[model samples]
Target: MQYDFDKIILRNGTNAIKWDGLDKTFGAADILPMWIADMDFEAPQPVIDAVVNRAQHGIYGYTEKPESFYSSISNWMKKRHGWQIDNKWIEVSAGVVPAISLSILSYSEPGDKILLQSPVYYPFFSAIESNNRVMVNNQLIYENHQYKIDFNDLESKLKTGVKVIILCNPHNPVGRVWSREELEKIGELCIRYNVIIVSDEIHSDLIFGKHTHIPIASISEELAERTVTCMAPSKTFNIAGLYTSAVIISDDTLRGEFKNTMNRLNAEAKNLFGIIALEAAYTYGEEWLEQALPYLEGNLDFLVDYFITKIPNIKVSKPQGTYLAWLDCKELGMNQKDLVDFFIHKA
Candidate 1:
């Protein structure tokens, strides 16, 4: 336990969206902001050291991602997730959303269809519709307070000519880590229908008890060919402001298409500090993560207990992955506005 998670870090005036943007976004300076994904803690010291070292070097120049960058990613994937990746398979983007947006541009024509699972990361809707692609949601099945993929519905959507499907591994909001079998089903479906899979796996590293995140690409070579697996240290290491993410496309043609799209917009290169911070994180942040996860799980346990004991009316779904807790606000009988008001004003 080298790092402390219980200490509340004051973030006011730090320009942090979670803390500083509260007044601007919610029209009040006093509401405790918990809507965003970023954590309230500081990054591990090694990541801080790397960024500070880069800053102190005083040469802020355009830089290319070196071979070590690829090595760190490859090694991390191999050691942590049991997936071996070639350096050639990796590509850089500012963030996962940007990578998905680029995936939309690279793989599909305007007016084509893209598929997603809902209630998913809300940005998937924007990434599809913003790029003039039709958004198709294969609504998830929520039974007994757990989310399961509706394979029949997903297959039905693919039949409508979905060119791409964005997967949120260890899914956002509702945190269910897709099992290997689940990924196999998804991969097989994409192969059968020729739908390219764009997996937004930014939350992959934050998995919880008895849940493992199998990269949809790692399920098989064919799946890898059709899948663009997007990941970042930003979520795991709390560095989203750095704007760094990795997009892995195993097929040569798909990789070339993605690289071309990035080149056209000069988005291939990563931010200088992001580059250093990412390498440091993947290489040295494992120890910090081992400690951070239990703290997160403990936090969830605390919330569940507190709710049952003190606020018996509220129900929360304990997450299998990610720090997010999806609360069932239904018992309060609040509409959308009422829900927002209750969180902001009532409790």
Candidate 2:
């Protein structure tokens, strides 16, 4: 079935964080919100159907994760990325950011150093700092309108006894889908320095054109052992409100420790609707995603053309993956606040 992406449903009164917070967030009530990561489109019918079917049952209670839940995720990983993951390696979490915070608690001590590439998903900074861990910014070098990792800087930071690195695979904001060679370089550094890598592959399914997302753990058995790959159908299927995600730890020992941490914190349970939505998205949302990517790419193209033709001073880094277009408004001779104000006023 053809999905209708052009129909702009009014989200203003729905209490959407993206829509409702425009005034509070950017200090303007009238700004068009292209800021949040969630799409303006509706979720696929299968996902909606699954959640509705679960609601029809009417008995919402504490739930145990079913074997099918694990199987759906495992199968999807294999089918989508050609990566083999056993059901035993899966850990359920409410979301990727929560899983990362728990990983900080599980693997690193307070005052231990964690590495992040910026300007990344802002939560990466929050996850480390809020957990009482030190954050090391291995900031990406922006050149030629694309962001590249500064390996020399990363090596220097890793040498300082960093304990963990939060990697954004198909990174947010800057939108660089890490190449195998790039991931191998990162893997090499982490392996050598004995740093635990938390590879958040939440945007793995949203890539465009020849760009492909390589799971950092999939590089090698050694790397997989040191990696905790956080993934979700939420971003892929536009179901962030579902709050379901998978934390894949291939190393049995690491998985055990992570599970122990979850158990200690009592955060292992999955919501009933979350479980059904996740299963449906992984099992049947592929075709919808296949269609959605091109439309999003079209949106990216439109933004590019619009900027070049109408707003030439505004520079947008063409996203390699993910729906977010990182617009460099610095050249417009305005401070960050001024740029935000400009967008708000214009929108």
List model 1 lDDT by residue over 14-63, tens digit each. 88888888888888878878889999888999999988988998999988
lDDT of each: 0.89, 0.91
lDDT of 2 by residue, 1-347 (tens): 88988988898888999999888887887767777889878899998898888899999998888899999999999999989999999999999999999899999999999999999999999999999999999999989878999999999999999999999989998889999999999999998999999989999999988998888888899999999999998889889988999999999889999999999998874788899899999998988998999999998999889998898887886789998888877777988777666677863
For candidate 2, what is the TM-score? 0.97
Q: Model 2, which residues run further than 4 Å from truth?
A: none
Clash count in backbone of candidate 1: 0
- Candidate 2: C-alpha lDDT: 0.91
Q: lDDT, candidate 1, residue 143?
A: 89
